[model samples]
Target: MSDLSRLSLNQATIKYAGMEQAVSACLRAEIPGIGLWREPVAEYGLRKTGALLRQAGLTPTSMCRGGFFTSPDSDQRIKDLADNRAAVDECAELGVPELVLVSGGLPDGSRDVDGARSMVLDSLAELAPYAGERGVRLAIEPLHPMFCSDRCVVATLGQALDLASRFPAEQVGVVVDTYHIWWDPTVYQAIERAEGRISAFQVCDWITPLPAGVLLGRGMMGDGCIELRRMREAVDKAGYTGPIEVEIFNQEIWDADAMEIAELTAARYVEHVL
Candidate 1:
């Protein structure tokens, strides 16, 4: 097997491609697994996408998401819980062992970061058991601190691990994405602390002059200052032996040919992350 056997293409890295095309790109690039998003999977029909992965011999390493429990409104919180349950069910159907969670930010007009994080804990306390019953691990992903107010309140690997520790390791875990936590001074220590709680590991470099919304500014591997290989080694040392997913969310990368992007991603993974 090639060294890239553990490399998985995250569909968001090639958001322009359809599910079939993205899986095809992974196959053509000889990648063994894929990290899928819920939107396209639902659009293609969950059962159909599951069948496609089976036929193509592609492993669904992790599902994109299933969390947004920071809302203050009771109705909104109920809706978020319902949606996350559905996502858990879909994860079971897709045979993906892990469902990535991007816990929502503080509710509108609210400045309570601690309260929002507590909400996340409460939400996970409810959903983790449901996911565990279905054999799907909830992988809590910590977005960068810059997104603390808008995207995710969980801003560090330590925070993610702390939240995940509330549940059984098999049911809840943390995702150590290089793009988000590379700048942290205590990241390596957190990785060691995570140990068996890492469910998925994602790679994307960080770049300057973030875009208007700061959502599409992820740099491709090796294009920025993140020590991709160092982070990978840290996760490995933490006892994680799963797919290393590439999840870049940039418009320029999306504009490129999907196959080219896959090929280049493979090369970069070898150069910078292996």
Candidate 2:
């Protein structure tokens, strides 16, 4: 296998592509792995999707998400746990080893960030073992602080690691996404401390004047200010010898040809990440 064997395309990078299209693009690009999102997998039917991936020799590096346990509503919290449990089951069925968890931000009209974080821990305590039982590791993904108000309160790798440390390394781990945590001053140290708890490494360049809601503004590699190679080296030094998934969420990229996007992503991985 070539060095690019460690490169994977996250489905979100090409939101316009269907599962079949994405899989075909990955095969066309000679990419070995992919990161899947829950909705698409469900839409494609879990068993069928798993079979397709296996037949094509494609590995599902990780699943998109299985968390949102920051709601102050008791019923909502219960429902969130139930949904996460189902996500864990899907991970097992799809043979995915990692299920990324994006801890939701503060509750509606609330300033209690601490309370929200505590709820994440509480939810994990219940879901971690449930996931572990099915041989799936729950990966806590810390989004950028800009998303701390509505998306994910876990805004740093250290915060993710701190939460993951509460459980066994095999049952819980942290996702190191450069797009999310690149500006963090202590990211390298956190990577080192995450030694055995690094579950997935996602890459995307950071750009300014983020789009309206700031959800679809990620720049392609080499188009922004993040030190991509430096971050890759840090994750490598931390003993994470897994796929470096390119997870750009830019609308412009999404509107491009899916196959071309895959090819460009691979080339960018070579130029900026490897």
**Candidate 2 error regions (>4 Å):** none
CA-lDDT, candidates in order? 0.93, 0.93
Model 2 lDDT, residue 264, Cα = 88
For 137-253, candidate 2 gives per-residue lDDT tens digits of 999999999899998999999999999999999999999999999899998999999999999999999888888858888999999999999999998998999888999888899
lDDT (Cα) of model 1: 0.93
Q: After superposition, how far is residue 156 of candidate 2 from its true place, in Å?
A: 1.0
Candidate 2 has its poorest 10 consecutive residues by lDDT at 1-10
How many residue pairs clash per model?
Answer: 0, 0
User: Estimated TM-score per prediction?
Assistant: 0.98, 0.98
lDDT by residue (177-203, candidate 1, tens digit) is 998999999999999999999999999
Could you tell me the lDDT of residue 142 within candidate 1?
96
Residue 10, candidate 2: alpha-carbon lDDT: 95
